[model samples]
Target: MAQAKKQSSIKVKVQKFGTALSGMIMPNIGAIIAWGLTAAFFMYPHGWFPNKEINNLVNPMLRFLLPLLIGYTGGKMVDDDRGAVAGAIGTLGVIVGTDQPMFLGAMIMGPLSAWLLKKLDQVFQDKIKSGFEMIYNNFSLGILGMIMAIFAYFIIGPVMEVGSQWASAGVNAIIRVHLLPLANIIIEPAKVLFLNNAIGNGILVPLGIQQAAQVGKSVLFLMESNPGPGLGILLAFTLFGKGKSKSSAPGAAIIEFFGGVHEIYFPYVLMKPSLILAAIGGGVTGTFLFTTLGGGLKAAASPGSILAILLVSAKDAYFGNIVGVLGAAVVSFIIAAIILKHDKSTGEDLDAKQKEMQAMKAESKGQAMPEAEDAHESVKSYENVKKVIFACDAGMGSSAMGASLLRDKFKKAGIDVSVTNTAVRNLKDEDGLLVVTQEELADRSLQKTPHAMHVAVGNFLSSPKYDTIVASFKALTQVEDKPKQEKPVKKVGSIDGIDFSKVKEVNFIRHDQHLGTATMATSLFSDAMKKAGKTTPVKAVRINELTDDPSHLVIVTPAANKNLAVRYSDIQTLVVKNLLQDKKLNEAVEKLN
Candidate 1:
């Protein structure tokens, strides 16, 4: 457990950092699109709507506006609005001190600066005298923001500038030698390993910005933003894969290719390691063609959508860029199909995917991978869980799909359980809630919901653990309880007004949420029923899980939801509130008997 916790913590840091970078870019993507359009059109000479004034908005937006907004987002994740202000101010200093836009630096420094202020507030917020609270809050933030701005300017800002020059020179050299395809050797694997955004935002974006600033366009933007490799892998899964992969692959292809959700296809590649070669092939082909054809986007495409690519492309480079993307996809698809077709299934593909996800997650954070037995283990009493939530960096894409998959599994098992997904940061530590997050973000999710149960999966889309997890949910003893609102009437070895023989499953119903008290009460009643010679199965269920099956007995508790009878009109519900009372519990149990 200790080792598992340690490894998960490492994954959290890496995933959270990735999330922070994404937070810096994804939400503010419109700005990226706007800038892309402005650059491709207004900024270029002889281009449509060319205007020197629109060109002026380009550098400032990259260096200041987008970075600051992203910083604000990252800081807000750590604290709130105060962090946002501090994050933006610190990022602003970086923008001022460097010609390079500092995409990665803004993401890191902004969050760090905000985190500092949040920590200060945590330590000093209560210590300040009540009369001076407002003064302290304002002055504290003012001083902290100023200090961070200065630090960013003198330290982070200038350092990133020098680093940017070195990275640009390295990339430029690779481009000049036509060895740009060699980059896919690292890029393809890293993208599948969940570093797609980091590479694009941190390395490629800044390089692209520098090049575009110099020559009005840069192929650097297409390095990882082409989306061709991912689209190819998904297409392969749709055509050549077996089992669930074949069924899920086509829609995944659409979401990834058109929706620009590249992460959707990651698990497909990770499921079959050989598929990485397909990704590499596609990526190399794409990059090589781009370099050969002089294809470059005026700015980053953000989602790597083909449409986004063309929209951001220089007028003459548009067709070439599209061809490169399509060419890469074709190459990747052919390779992936050949690989998946002839390669026999190991039946352990799910395990392989999980290990890959967790292992990459561990390596990214510089930690020892947790033992296989310690990974993706189920929560204690997971069967009794009221709900399962699949969470990711941004709640929208991967999380949503994971939730749907798990929901389907539960439905197939005839289980009525709540399965959902959300952004990790939005999670609340509520009772009986199980949070299933990617191994990379498990620790971050755990920190947010310490009381809630958590399970970390390698890949949300392909983990086989879902079956085991749903089985556990099925195993949670079916039990519920109702409070005693009336007196128990004694009968001769039987409850006077009820027929116990007619019942098979005795369901104890909670009026509100079950925190285990009602279950316990129902258990005591179950024992009492045995004492009274009843052979019926006494089970407990949440109000939410109560079905309209006519054969089962639902014992409703005090203040019980009246909607139960209304919803399950054909079923009989006995109102027995406060079942923990011995007389009432005994009588209730006798009724089940």
Candidate 2:
């Protein structure tokens, strides 16, 4: 059910291009690693069986299998099944023409071939007749695949070979001279900007695994995986930061250092963009030390976790790796602290912005609900209410905290209700349950659990609405809505101290309010009464339209605008609280003839 995430940022095309590159490589990394391991164990100069038979498997794997896999992955990204087929076919030409393995060539042509076919389909797709659709699909792909294969062999394969060799030479020269520190210029900024996941997991890890297999270790493993930069930044905040950041920095540091959740520190750096210098300084310092000491690991330390790194350490370089990490952290922390002190950004603004972000983040998952009122109200009884639940996307973080806060509030109020948190997807319709979520998600939550009373808040952490809800719970015990007999009671059907019956028309009045809760509630209640065989017209009118007419039953919506209602209360009147609840609505309607 996971759709491709929409990317709208124009700063770089990385979300599309970088993500596609990562997607193509990640799925086949296991196979690539398997080939590398096979070569190391059975076909290398140090292999037990260094014979021609072992060498035979190696060449075919490098030339045919690897390139085809890359091509298939690349093509699939562009145009699914047909793209994969075309990519594989085009890559075969590269495999045939080149004595050397066409790694780079396969990557380029795979997605390129897929993209080319996708364009062809876009052009011919509308023209193809319904009955001949299958034939068109098959023949078009076949012809295009043949064309790309021929083109790859004659044109692209040779040119890519030279380019790959040149890139390789440049990289080797940089590594040899220990100018690898220069890489931090790009790496540090990318990591801070959240592009590190693609750079590390997609590109570096697979290549690192290949290198590690042949030489028993690879410095490439440490390039993007070093956690020192983020760790240093978080540590700096923990020691010398200001405002909400100072309070939050310790928790962020613990998670980043021990849990390897580097994203915890991203917001802190983003608060002050100049802090990127701290990251780069740390990255360069760590990488330089790692390169100088020839520090590496036997495998990719995924998560860039220090514990994962230590567990996969290459022999004779463990101490050097540890020393490099420490050096990076200390240097980054010092620079970050200086930058933080010099920057004059206000803490209150950051705190407010952070809260806004949290609210906005939850809001993005849903849309505003229709304000149109429902004619048939199905209000769930709170008489036997046993539990309340807070529901959200993941259920573990914000929802859980909201549930806990509500639970604490209930305890203080002496309410014997059980409160819990759950994922929205896990909700089941049940009686005596209350479902609370952000207002934006309220509609979805109601759809999932219509039997439960749905409550919504603009924010979960702190809101005044919870207090109003608790007061409502107290009133639940005192009020009992039932069909009335002949005898009339004083102040009956009172909502915020206004009641009405035995009037010619229930005139709904709003001064300047547009189509909202007032308009909706009036339309629905009026329609319902008309359906129930009541002859009295339910009229909508403006405040200025009303006269000193005692025949009219005037009611106001949001009923909090009591000042407006007081202006015309001489006649029968009802001030509807926030909404038209079924119980209160029934009492007022049933009281009529």
Candidate 3:
């Protein structure tokens, strides 16, 4: 029975792995469509819209909007509002930091951010209680969301950018300064173990491109036809794989090599870390073979899969490709077999460590303790403690931003409150602590504290929604304040002579890659508007100076389309869209429109 249970567990794990892998690939379906469309227009200039104009519009839209949409949707599916907000913020971070277009950044960062946020939320969710909800629901949650966004922007974004650049540079330097054989020997190992595709393409190909072009060959042709790390993995499996896993190894290698899904081998490698060296050895061998055989590819072969290589390789390099693939496979198999002979079980230790960590977390959060203790504590000091503390991954960026925003809102409403930012782990004893985070981070220790409240802020801090939160807190606290009447706004005219009554309002989606606050707002507004049967164009605009002109409107026309330029002057009202500032003008425009 125990043996059967273990097999069942392994089967379940495999099933989950397959499902996740499939899901990850599904997004690429849309990505391929976008890539194909863009490639067609770039390659065939006379096919559709004017090449230059189409290029300009399509690039920005794909880079920014498409990724944002996909990420937001994915996040929503994962963790609802909070995940959606995090996805949007992560997409913005990628856009601001990378020189690459938004589409690629979004593709990578959106899911990554969502995953991080979800994980963080799970780690901190249980420590909050209902009494503290007054504060948790008010400002603490938003503050936490902001902190997470900032962490992603400053830490993750820059590291990825620098890493890509450095890897590319290092690869090129090796190939240029050393002999082709020596260079391959070094690069192959790095690619196999570290899975550094950026280094391979960014550095290796540029050198190969220049070398091939100089020698009267197409740069693209050389890159496309080249066999890469995939071949190395295959070689290792062919020689080393034996017994029950032998057949699985060759099949897995072929899938990884040809399908360009490098992750397929991760389980195998994880099961035996010594395979790292073996894979590296194979990689170096393959690289040497590739250079010697004059193997090259025209385009990048992501996943280094055999199929991707074949698709991108030059027509005449078929023999060179086969030789390189076989060479890498043989070398890797020998290395892996030698390494695996000395390998031991590492999963048992890892499982033990995971359990230990969970226990520690439970203790720290007070979940393992009794409920009566918490009830007794809450009753002891129910009236005197009036403060709420907000904790996040980092106290600097989002926490600070959120705290400041909430502070202003609370002050404006004449609600007296105190708030501070602290790392989640640093949170200590407080009278009425409200722990605001994703559901994942709620701790039982937080609940046992008697006055603690856990409110999940999903992600992304909206000032308007937070204002309502402050209002709720004020009501709960019985703070006395007179309500102010809504101010009347001057009516603005529209150019189309369409009934002003039909137009609801004009709003701007301001974003600068640091925080996608604008995109989140726009998405919310659009969703709300669509529900109400409203339609409006969301235009992109550049804001040069904050104080340039409150009344000045700048109209941007498509390139070489002077005929459309005069249309702006003919309109009575201008709805400007700047993805930077959150202001009353947006509301006014929305209302007027």
Best by lDDT: 1
Q: Any runs in candidate 3 off by more than 4 Å, and if so which?
A: 1-58, 61-81, 93-171, 178-278, 289-304, 312-323, 333-593
CA-lDDT, candidates in order = 0.73, 0.66, 0.46
Candidate 2 per-residue lDDT, tens place, 550-570, comes to: 566666544434655445435
Using TM-score as the yardstick, the better of models 1 and 2 is 1
Report the candidate with higher lDDT, 2 versus 3: 2
Q: Pick the candidate with the highest TM-score.
A: 1
List TM-score per model, in order: 0.67, 0.54, 0.34
- After TM-score superposition, what is the CA distance of residue 5 in candidate 3 from its true location, in Å? 24
Write down the worst ten-residue block by lDDT for model 2: 370-379
Better of 1 and 3 by lDDT: 1
Please give the distance, in angstroms, between residue 38's alpha carbon in candidate 1 and its true position after superposition. Answer: 2.3
Residue-wise C-alpha lDDT for candidate 1, range 112-212, written one tens digit per residue:
99999988977986465323444666689889999999999899988988887887788888889999899889988877766677677656775676687
Ranking by TM-score: 1, 2, 3
Error of 3 at 132 (Å): 18
Sorted by lDDT, highest first, which candidate order results? 1, 2, 3
